[model samples]
Target: MASESDGQGRLPTGIPWSSPTVRVVLLSTVLAPLGVPLISPALPTIRDVLALTDAQASLLVDRVGRRRVLIPSLFAFSLLGAAVALGPPYWVVLAVRVVQGTAAAALFITTVTLIGDTFEGVRRNTVLGVNVAVLSAGAAVYPLVGGALAAVSWNAPFAVYLVGLPVAVLAYRVLPEPAGERERRSVSYLRNVVSALPAREAAALYGSAFLIELLLFGAALTAVPFLLDGTYDLPAVLIGAVVTLTEVASVVTSALNGGFSRRVSNHGIIAAGFGIVGGGLVAAWWAPTLGVLVAATAALGAGWGTVLPSLDAGVSEGVETRFRAGALSFRNSTTFLGRALGPWLFTTLVVGRGYRPLLLVAGGCALAFVPVVLLLGRRG
Candidate 1:
C-alpha cells in the first residue's frame, strides 16, 4: 500500500492554509456548524411565525458518507437549504432541515477523513486544530448574517445554504479521493468498524466527543439565545452578535489547540475542558449582567476549542489506520446524536422550570464527568 505521504510532498511542519486540499476541506467542514447557528438567531421569529411553543421550537434547529458522497452531500445541503426558504408548511420545513443535517454530516465525516488521509502525526493534529478553528469561524459569522437577514424575513437566512453549491464545485475540482483509499477496503464492513473500536481509548474518545457536543448544544447553543431573548429582550441581531463572541473565543482557542496538545495529555485536556465548560455554565446560571453572560459564553467556547481538536486528533491517531474510516464515522455519529439529544433533553427539563435551572443542571452534569474521565484515564 502506498503511504499517505507518498504523492503529497507537502511540508510537514507548517500549517498548510494555502493548499487547495486543506482549503476545500476547511470550507466544507465549516458548513457543519453553519447549518444550525445560521438559523439560531432567527429561531424566536420562526417560532412566533409558526406558532411553535418553546419545546416545538427546539425541534427545528438541527451527515453521510466519505469520499463517495462528498459532492452529492454538498448538493443536497444546497438544495435543502434553499427549499426551506420557500415558506413551506412547518412540517415540510422541519423535514428539509432534517435532510440538510444529513448533508452536513457527510461534509463533516468526509473532511475529517480527508485530513487523516492527507496528513500524519503532529501535522495531522495541527490541521485538525485549524479545521476546528475554521469550523468555529463559520459558527461565528453566520449568526450575525442570519440575524440581519432574519430581521428582513424569517426565510432570508436559508439562502446562506446556497453557499454550499460553490464550495461543492471547488471541492469537485480540487479534492480527489486519496490514493489507495479505495484499494484498502476490507470486505466485511461491520467487522472493520468493530475491530477499530475494540480499544478502550477509541470508546473513550467517542464518549468525550458525545459529551462535549451534548453540553455545547444543550447549554450554550440552544439555551443561550432563548435566555437572551426572553429575559433580556435582545433582538435577533444582538443575540447573533453575542453568539458570535462565543464562537470567536472558540476560534482563538482552537487555533492554539496544537500547542495545548503538545503540553497536555488528551485525557487531561478533555477533563479540564469539561471542567471549564461546567464552570462556564455555573457562571451563566449566576450571570446578573449581559457582560457576565458574554464572559461565560467565552468560557464555553474556550472549553470547546480546547477539547474538540484533541478528540478529533485522538480518533485519527489512536485508531488503527485500516479501520480508521469506520472509527471516524462512528465518532461523527456520536456527535450528531449528542447534538440532537441535547436540545430535546434541555427542552424536556426546561418545560416548566426555566433556562437558568437547566443551565445549573447541565453544569452539574459536566462537572460530574470529570472524575469519571480521570478514573478511566488511570485504568487506561
Candidate 2:
C-alpha cells in the first residue's frame, strides 16, 4: 500500500493542497458548487427552449429526495439507480438534478466526515473551513466559466463535470477511507443517526434556510445578472465575474473561519457568522456601489461557510459509527432542499414584485438569525 505521502515527501497533514485527502475535498467542493451556479444562469433559456412552464421546469430541477440519496449514500449501491432518471427529456433533466444535487451534498458532507476523522487539532477545522471556502470560490468562478460555455450552448456547465469527475476518481483512489468510529447498533442506520442529532432545532435550520436561500440563491443567479445587464448595460462576462466577487470574500472568510473555530467555541463562531451575514444584508439594502454590493455578498458567503462546518461537527458529535455517513448525508439532503428551492422562490418574487422587496426579504431572513444563535441546541 502507498504511504500517505506524495513524491515530494511531505507529512500528510502538513501539506494540504498536495495531500490526497485535501485533493478529494477540493474536487468535491468544486463539483458541488460548480453544478449549481454554472447551470443556473442558463435555466430560463432551457425552460423556454423546452417549452416548459415555470412550475414544471422548477419541479424537474428540485427533486428533494434525490438530494438526500446523493449526500448520504446510505444505501451504498443506489447511485447508479438515481443517475438513471436524471438523463434528459426536460422532466428527466429535472429528475437528474436530484442526482446532481445529492451528489454535490455527498461530496460536501462526506468531505466533512473525512476531514473530521482524518485530521485533528487546529488542522481539522482549518481543513474543513478551507474546503468550504474553496467550495464557495468554485461556485463563484464557475459562473463565468459556465456562462462563457453557455454563450455557445445552454448545457455548457454540465460539461465542466468532466474536469471534476476525473479528479473525484483520482481522489477516491488515493485518500484513505474514513474509518467509522461509533459503536454499531441494532436500530436502522437512518434512525440511529437521527437520534444523534437535535431534530427540532435542525428542522428550524431547515425552515430558515428554505426561506433565506430560496430568496438569496435564487435572486443572485436569476435576477442579479439581468438586473445589472438591463439596468447598467454591463457585459455578460463582467456580470459573470461580478457574481463571483462574493466568493472572493468567502475565500478570505473561510481561512478566517479555520482560525476562529479553533480559538472560539462552535456556538461562538456560528453566532458571529450570522451576525456578520445579517449585517452584510442590511448594508446591501443601502448598497449604492458595486464595491458595497460585493461586500455584502462576502459577508453572506463567509457566514454560510461558518454555519455548515459547525453544524456538521456539532450534530455529528454523538452519532454512532454505523450512522456517521448516514447522518451527514441527512444534513446534506436538507441543504440541497434549500438549494433547489432557493432560485425559484426568488424567481417567483421577481415575477410578483421586484428586486427591492427581494433584497429586503433576503437580508431580513439573514438578520432574523441574530437572535437564533442562543436557540440552536446549545451543544457547546
Candidate 3:
C-alpha cells in the first residue's frame, strides 16, 4: 500500500497533469463560472435587443453530480447555455437559464464530490487547490474573452458554453465511476448523512463558507467597482485591471494550497484566511490611494484562495465516505446562497450608509467569526 506521502514533491503529490481525469475535472472546473462572467460584457446588448429591464437583464449572471448524473447534466448545461445565443424572447431565455442553473448546480456539486471520491489526504487537498486555481484563472480570462466576443456579437459569448459538450464526451470516455458508488444510495442515506456530522462542526463549516462569500461579494467585489469609479475616478478599464488582481493573487495562493494544508490544520488555515480577509477589508476601508486599495484587494484575494479550497477539503474530509456527497451538497448550497445574497446585503445595508461602513462591518464580522472557526476546528 502506498503511503500518503508516496508522491510528495515541492509542487504537490500526484498532480497528474496529463491524466485524463485530472484534465477533465480541471477543465470542467474552468467552465463552471463561464455561465455568467462570459456573458457579462454583453449584457447591455442583450438587454437592448430584448428590451429588458435592468433587473431582468441582470438575471443572466448566477451560480451541479456523478456519471449517470454527470452526462445528462453536462449536456443540459451545454444546450441550455448555448440556446441563449438563439435570440430567444426574454422570458424564453430566462426559462432556459433557470433550468440551466439547475444543471449548473449539478455540475458544481458533482465536480467537488468527484474529487472527494477520487482522491485522499494531501493529494485531495492539492487537487482541490488546483481546481480552485483553474477556476480563478478561468474567471480572470473569461471576462476578457467575453469582452472580445461581445465586440463581435452579443451572442458570441454564449457559444463558449458549448465547450461543455466536448468535456462531457471526454468524461463519458475517460471518467470512471468510483468504486462502491452503487452502494451509496440506501434507504438510510439521508439519515446517515445527517447523523454523520456533529451539529456544531457542520454549522461552523457551512456558516463560514456562507459568511466568506457574503463578505467577499458584498464588501469587496460588488462595491469595489462603484467605489473605484466614484471615489477614485478610475476608468472602467483601470478598475477591471485592479479587480483582476484579486484573481491573480488567488491563483498564486491556491496553487500553493496543498503545501499550506500539509503544514496547517484545515481549520487553522480557514481561520487565518478569514482573519487575513478581515485585515484586507479593513485596509480597503482605510485605503487613501489607488495603490493601497489595489494591494488591499489582493490580500483579500489571497485569503479567498486559502479559505475556499480548505473549506471544500475540510467538508470532504470530515464526512464519512458514504455521506460525503450529501455533506458537500449542503456546503454548495450555503456557498451559492451566500454569493446570491451578498450583493443584496450590500445594497440593502450600504444604500445610504456608503461602502466604507459596509466594509468595516463586514470585515469586523469576518474577524469576529474567526474564534468560531478555531473552536470548531479544535473540536473536530
Could you say which candidate leads in TM-score? 3
TM-score of 3: 0.93
Ranking by lDDT: 3, 1, 2
Tens-place lDDT per residue, model 1, 294-358, is 79988998898888887877777766655677778889888878987887788788989999998
TM-score (all chains, Cα) for each model: 0.82, 0.72, 0.93
The residue ranges of model 3 lying beyond 4 angstroms of the native Cα positions read 1-12, 62-65, 183-188
Report the lDDT of model 1 for residue 69. 77
lDDT of 2 by residue, 144-196 (tens): 67567666765544655555545645654676654444445446755766776
In candidate 2, which residue ranges exceed 4 Å CA deviation? 1-19, 40-102, 150-159, 181-187, 199-215, 218-238, 288-291, 346-354, 375-380
- In model 1, where do residues sit more than 4 Å from their true spots? 1-11, 41-65, 83-96, 151-155, 183-187, 222-239, 286-290, 350-361, 378-380
Q: Rate the local accuracy (lDDT) of all candidates.
A: 0.80, 0.60, 0.82
The C-alpha local distance difference test score for the whole of candidate 1 amounts to 0.80
Error of 1 at 293 (Å): 3.5
- Best by lDDT, which number? 3
- Candidate rank order under TM-score: 3, 1, 2
Lowest lDDT 10-residue stretch of candidate 1: 1-10
- Quote the lDDT for 94 in model 3: 80
**Clash statistics: count for each candidate:** 4, 6, 7
